[model samples]
Target: MNSMQNYLADTVKSIPPSGIRRFFDLVTQTKGVISLGVGEPDFVTPWHIREACFYALEKGYTMYTSNSGLLELREEIANYMKKKIGVEYSPQREILITIGVSEAVDLALRALLNPGDEVLVPEPSFVSYAPGTVLAYGKAVSVPTYFEDEYRLKPEVLEKYITPRSKILILAYPNNPTGGIMEKEDLEKLRDLIIKNDLIVISDEIYAELTYNGGHVSIASLPGMRDRTIVLNGFSKAYAMTGWRIGYACGHPDIIAAMTKIHQYTIMCAPIMSQMAAIEALRHGESEMRRMVDDYNNRRKIILSGFKEIGLDCFEPKGAFYAFPSIKISGMSSEEFCEKLLMEEKVAVVPGNAFGANGEGHIRCCYAASIKNIEIAIERMGNFLARHRKG
Candidate 1:
């Protein structure tokens, strides 16, 4: 008989599973593991937001929302975007609620690609970008950014990767894994390049609310770029609502309409209760959001200082809750370092190679963990490093 595996599509079989999930699964089976592998916030979703969901259920709002999502939530999202980032979008035509930034990204890729297209992706980025590009029948061209440059994707680096086939540039400043942010001046350099290349952009700003230094900047707000940028954001990081699984895409109406068409057929809509809860999150949960960001900032300090004390070279993460530290002193590859550390000390952090090949020789430690856990993990890591250095 023919094998069932042989029946699967070649494209589906070719995609590799997420690298983060390997360490996570190991931690779940091991006892007393202190994990910094995942990027989820340690905080519970705010009570008032939960209460909004409960109230929606009480009012029997369990039916599917309109394929475009609740108008109320979209309006609130529009207002929030304007106040927070100085970007204006029409709630009716330019906003589409999605199943978190994950689906938003997928939809954007699907809407824009027409097979054999090229997407410029900055590395040491989140795991999904390259795979998502491939799934949408596009090629992902990796643009390397180094630790010496603080992991910022320079305009020159971006220019080298562009060709006639290049269609999109995926940007995730306040980036995952590295936690590096692009300043307005840094983005200004790209504005000319993007215009010169006639490229569209997919800007993932999921960590917008957690930025330090100056506030987060959306490239879509830059002059002459709004029509060519798709901004993907969600409530997962800022509102600690990962389980709610609601997000949105904002761009020109034509793109939004195209994304909405796919979302309608595939997702129908995001959960109705989540939409109701999101409205409350955008409208009344501002103070609570700020409180969480404040708490994360405090924990961020502890993690950065602790890494310094451990004698590891760590870049100061200006946004997001991750600390990417070099493990080159131990003479191990990023995967080897992470695996040995986990086995020796039961402290779990993802290897930098999980993000991209350019991330070798470093490890990603997520600080979206409790302060006590962060302290203990750091201590364990220090001990692990000491042993490895001696060996």
Candidate 2:
């Protein structure tokens, strides 16, 4: 087996396993752990959406959808995008359904990058962006966004990272780990820079519907960006449909065609039943989705208050269901803090560095868990911190 390892592709060997999953494996081994690690919604997929899938199955709609996905779903996505972001997309030519935003990310990178092209990824981001760049034969460049800026990517900072080799910029706001969001004005600042550099953007708006402060904004809606930006979104976060494995990408027809070529060969189409469920979600699921978002907002307030009471400085997260609080006060690295808290208090949270180096001094506490579990976890964490506080 040691000799066989030599035959592995260098690209595959170069990438490390997801740090988030590695630590969560330890959580699985521990009993009675209150987990605040995974970013998935705690709510069940709304009953109406599930019923739609069941009805589709009863009607014998289990066959493969077109490689671009069910036309109905794509049309619904088009309407949703137009209403949500004021952007128009041709469902036939510009939208391709994918196996989750995960697959959409991979497909976009694989279709867009050439060997040695640089992908500028704003850090403390979702864990997959860097590795996805590597897998696509691109160089992943980290563009650090400070907590002081509420983790929004700044135009001046982004300009410093651009070089002749930078080809793509990934925008994942309502971001993972940090729960940061980019408002319309923040994105407006980057518009000229993006156009000046001739770089394309992969805007992952998977959490678009979860924003609490105001409406979610897509760069694609900005002037001159519609043609250069690929928008990725899905039913996972908002609809609590993570297991459904359905997402879609909207971009220029040329880019969409390229992505579809790769997706057709690799994934074919998202599950047909899931596609059926998604159509119902877009048409009639907004009320339940809003109710869930309202619930998350309440949980968000409680967790932020809990961290403040514990003497951890946590920024207010305006979107997404996470609270990132600095753990430096405990005088332990993020890993040390998380591991000790889990072992001593049976509360599981992810170390920040798992997302990127900029995350080293903080810890990501997902508010997606129940309010009861979140409260208990916070109390446990406070106890653990008091015992472990350095003089």
Which one wins on lDDT?
2
Mark the regions of model 1 whose C-alpha exceeds 4 Å error after superposition.
none
Cα lDDT tens digits for candidate 1, 1-391: 7679989887778888898998999999989999999899999999999999999999999999888899999999999999988999999999999999999999999999999999999999999999999999999999999888888889988999999999999999899999999989899999999989999999999999889888999999899999999999999999999999999999999999999999988999999999999999998999999999999999999999999998999989999999999898899998888888888899999999999999888899999899999999999999988888734
TM-score of each: 0.98, 0.99
> lDDT per residue, candidate 2, 1-391, as tens digits?
4488788999899988887897789899999999999888999999999999999999999899899999999999999999999999999999999999999999999999999999999999999999999999999999999999999999999999999999999999999989999999999999999999999999999999989988999999999999999999999999999999999999999999999999889988888999999999999999999999999999999999999998899989989899899999889999999888889999989999999999999999999999999999999999998898778
Query: Cα lDDT of all candidates, in order?
Result: 0.93, 0.94
lDDT of candidate model 1 versus the reference: 0.93
Measured with C-alpha atoms, the lDDT of residue 168 in candidate 2 is 100
Clashing pairs in 1: none
